[model samples]
Target: MTVSPATASAPLARTPLDRRVEPDLRVALCAAICVGLALLWWVRGGWIFPLDDAYITLHNARVLIEGHDPNYGVPALVGASSLIHLSLVTAFSLVLPGEAAAYLVAGIGPVLFLAGLLTLAQRLSLPWPEGIALALAGLASGTGQFLNGLETGLVMAAVTWTLVLALDRPSRLLALICGLLPFLRPELGLLSLILMTRQTWSRLAAGSDRAAALRAVAADAALALAAASPWLLWNLAATGALLPRTMAAKQAFFGHPPGSLPASVVYAAAMTAGGIGPAAAALLFLGRDGPGPALLWFVSLFILGFALTNREVLAHNGYRYTFALLPIALFAVMRLGAARGPSVLRLLILAQWAVALAVAVAAPTEIAAQQERVAQYRAVAHWAQANLPQARLLIHDAGVIATASDLPLTDLVGLKSPDSIADHRRWTAPSNGAERFRALDAIARRSGVTHAIILDDAPDHFWASLADDLRRGGWSLDPIETGSARGPYILYRLAPPTDPAAK
Candidate 1:
């Protein structure tokens, strides 16, 4: 393959403070370098920092690994499911157990995601180095909630590549895989359907075989429906609708007195940009495309629609929920820089990598610095995992607690209520309000939750309300030990005996 001049200098340019190397091994070289950088980021800040939503996925895997049915409480709530992680749990269950398997799975998921994305770019006729650059761009951008510890990165990569392959060949096997996309992430699956529908409509308008297009559409839809059947069935049984997993959380948030569109917009913007810079920049540059600019317009509208509807902005920000549109964003960027020489394109790509590396390196210690004030909350999480019987403990902040403790959280308060479970499918914090708190307490009691976890950051928040309720119910707050600068986390255990004299 002939290398473009612009692409050649990208990795070779010397920075005064940063090391640089020109890639020569083509795909292998580019991929290896990118993987090395990701590893550096993962090791430097991510390894110890705890992935935002990784704990929930890890918890689910742990359940299966431990020979227990991996129930993250979605079955009884609003009816949502994650077959991809469930499958991982089953695979890990065969040999590895507990945190051992969970960590491996968690770490590998992102790599797979990056690979799948590169595969998709290849299908689009992008050269290997270009594809690698795009994949790295996706990772660094943090769009689609890459930094959220949600499995969106991998899941999106899988779904996007699946669609690309499906479109290129439209094979039964590829179609089948494409159909199962919804099983990995429902929102992305729905987005796939929408994009396919648009494509099919265009084909029909162009005088292609209508019957064939109809068949293709039907096949795709059937596969999607079949893949989603588990959740649909669960929802029918639980909530009487094929709604989000946490329908209760959604109702609670929407019904809040102060909640409205303006608030959602604020949350959405924060989610779109919070901590993840490259992805955000890609999204902003999506308009710089072709003669018709059809793809650009389509993606922009798609994301804008999602933002308008998205309610609760999650902790990992809005990475997962918005990840479905990232491929289009990347494609747009690729096209924008296509006119520039290859070296310049590679340089831009290298710059993105540099930024991601800098951000990740700074994140760990910066986050550690703030851990002291949040120590009490982390301590309680540790105590709950150690002392209390682990029968589906419910927590407000799934990432902060579940990832740190390597414990499974049964129910997250606001996962489906506009926050999108793509981050922490098993756990999410409730939106602000008195009703939200009451709902959290009610769910804890009804679901037979063994323990409740709380942080003192917000007095009127769900954690505070749960603490007050537990205290009234005669529960004692015990301190738990933790690592690093994390403060004392208070575990609210149900009081032992009514009579102190009995002891």
Candidate 2:
């Protein structure tokens, strides 16, 4: 008797065709377990360490909430990217509370980032369990310091969502969001856009319908223009240039006689190794046969390129700007799953997560300690606010002091804008520390720049000179010890000197 076609095509081995899903389910469950472990490790660590640039972000948000320009309290070393991102979070926080805003950002950033990448993985035809596992690995690799009490997670979430948009839909609304990336952190955003747009255009070109391609391009352009309008309009109103605050920070920090080439390279290297292991970084760029290796490559390239191009010296506090391009870490993990087999990829991803967890634990607990210093400025800012009527205060340290106090702000650090200072000597040369002190004193006397508060722990060069000048001028310095406050800080009251020169 001849076997029927259906009987001849019977299910292989033991399981019936209808119930052949056990293997996939088992793989998926295992993947879920791996991913869950990594996420658990991350959330276990509450938001700690305000980080190097976190103070700047927090200051910007608080300043906006206090009815000051977002630029107020912006440190000399920070970029406007952080200020812009935090300003939006501040808007949310304003309706709620600062801590509420912080929690919202901490929770929402990861959720949004994970959701977007999962959607993109679906679009790429990755298996659901496999996609989640890869995405989780990518998350662990990219978000090494994500749990920190700052806006880095928000920025990374935005970038991840941006990539998802680029891959899955390529809609104009997504493009608008993508355009906003550069404003948050130009280097990462710009590079990512270049790669994403190129890939998008390539896909569009391959499509049979010319009309569809044209619409996609038009949509991208429209969204980009709309999202970028604020930066351009703000520049026109403030500095008459499309670039606000970014150029100023660059010129001040990297575009000096020494330049910031070494610093840029170091930052790039640190970023590559920061979230995922260095091996992951290498695989991201080198992995050619991965499912979405092109996307991962672009993500990594943009992140690394933007970081290095900034060319600024590494801040001692931490490289907080690295947060902006952190999505590449997630992308790298996804590539690992695609290029290597799922089982091998699972082991590698777990190892990467373990690295991130280790680093997370090793990081110091005193991350947000600077909140105390910010408190110091709050104590004295009241006196300045009541007595002096200036819209902005130039502080020696752009800590919580600037943010806690309801004052528009500037920094004397010469990191934000080298040209803000009349004398180039102070910024370029070490002796300019004395000149800066004298200049601050002169400004206080002439411009009614009410206060020149200094931190006892701040750099000796500038703080010492300012203190000396205040003393010599007979300006009585009233010190408020921090023990009387909620956090660490000092309040100095500068009164007009009995002798004019003594001030």
Candidate 3:
């Protein structure tokens, strides 16, 4: 009934569990739930992920398993958003089939994610039930994102447990994990950067033993970087950039300043809902105690960065970027003792599971719809793979195509082709559709692109009125062959090689 501000490091000793419960028992519940959900998904979708991007990683894993060069046209076609996720799936594929390996790594993340909550509960000495509630509430806030094949469960597990470790005390282990953040997911690296920035500021402001504090900061920062050095060095060596081509691709295709009031509110509101507290709670608990200040710092700055960088302003991307703020909020409200784990938590937990269940029921159908489009494109892709073996296919999205056929691809959005980043920009430019199509058609012709396909149903922000654009641009469309996959796809023949040998 009372709100008390305390430091994030303060002990949550108000109500310890009266009965002892084995940690493994809590862990087993998490593992069981994860398996059950995966089974439900597999039964319906047959290993097709709700997100096509999952297949990108799956395809790359198979490439590694076969000992083929992972890179395609470019040496830096790292091909996955998470190097860590790709590496884990590749390792799992050594013993299991490629699809099953992807499935296993996928399941481990949520298991570790929920298990880490129990670990947090034990460290806080809270009752076991509260731990499960926090975990479920987490699922609710980002239910759809976790199953997205972005290695979300893993990213969350690392972030949540890292927060847990940071709360306990600083250690070499914590430094190692903090350094590994970017490999988990690039957005997560922001968490470490923000937390360290807070630590550096606090120490400097204290005005005592300044040299000692600076040395400590430098050493910890070095350790964190050292832990991440391999992935960092490899990216730099291969791509000549610190971040992957994905960043460049995103910047070109969907990057926009977060200037719109409505878009900003929707983005902030989603964070507020996920954190399960009013947005103002961030200001209240910040700098009061615990990781609350640092986490709030991370979320705010991340939102700022995203607003400046993204055109897709909704909270969850098909490639999920949100993580850990829920735990941070839960920790904040609980440590502050605000409303003492409100009764509303029960309703919220039920709602989250309901969403997860709903996703399980609906995701298969959604995947089927995507597959219909994938099949539409696949006809062109398969023919190129067999008939014109040396030619590369250019397409809008790269995930399913990467796995479905052996055809090499130049990603229209540039995930696999950094050189096309400008083309991606032109394709998604705010310009009229006909103008956009002419610009792209010219580029494709010059690049010797013939087997090019694009989705007619992409978001308007990406491109608009494609059928009109093609007609206006003096272009004719080739309909895909008859099948279940026949849909609104346009194949443009930009100078198909006449002689079979010319291709």
lDDT of each: 0.49, 0.52, 0.60
Question: Candidate 3, which ten residues in sequence have the lowest lDDT sum?
Answer: 1-10
1-503, model 2: which lDDT tens digit per residue? 11111111121233253135534543554456446545744674433234334545555566555644444433222334543556666777777666445555555556566666665554444445666665665555444345555556667677776656554434566666766766665554565466446646665867799887877787777777788787667645644445545444433323332336556555656654553464345344434432245555555564445454442332333455554545655555554444454665467556766775665555534434553444444656665556555545545565454445556554554434333444323432334233344544554565444455565554434344556665654566676443445432345556766666742
Per-residue error (Å), model 3, residue 66? 5.5
Tell me each candidate's TM-score: 0.65, 0.66, 0.80
TM-score of 3: 0.80
Off by over 4 Å in 3: 1-9, 12-19, 37-46, 62-72, 199-215, 255-287, 313-319, 336-380, 383-392, 424-435, 458-473, 482-485, 488-503
Taking the tens digit of each residue's C-alpha lDDT, what string does model 3 give over 392-473? 5657667666676766666655676666567657654444222455444544444555565666665643433543444444
Our tally of clashes for model 2 stands at 14
Per-residue CA lDDT of model 1 for 35-55, tens digit only, reads: 774675567543332433444
**Per-candidate RMSD vs. true structure?**
8.4, 8.3, 5.1
Clashes of 1: 19
Ranking by lDDT: 3, 2, 1
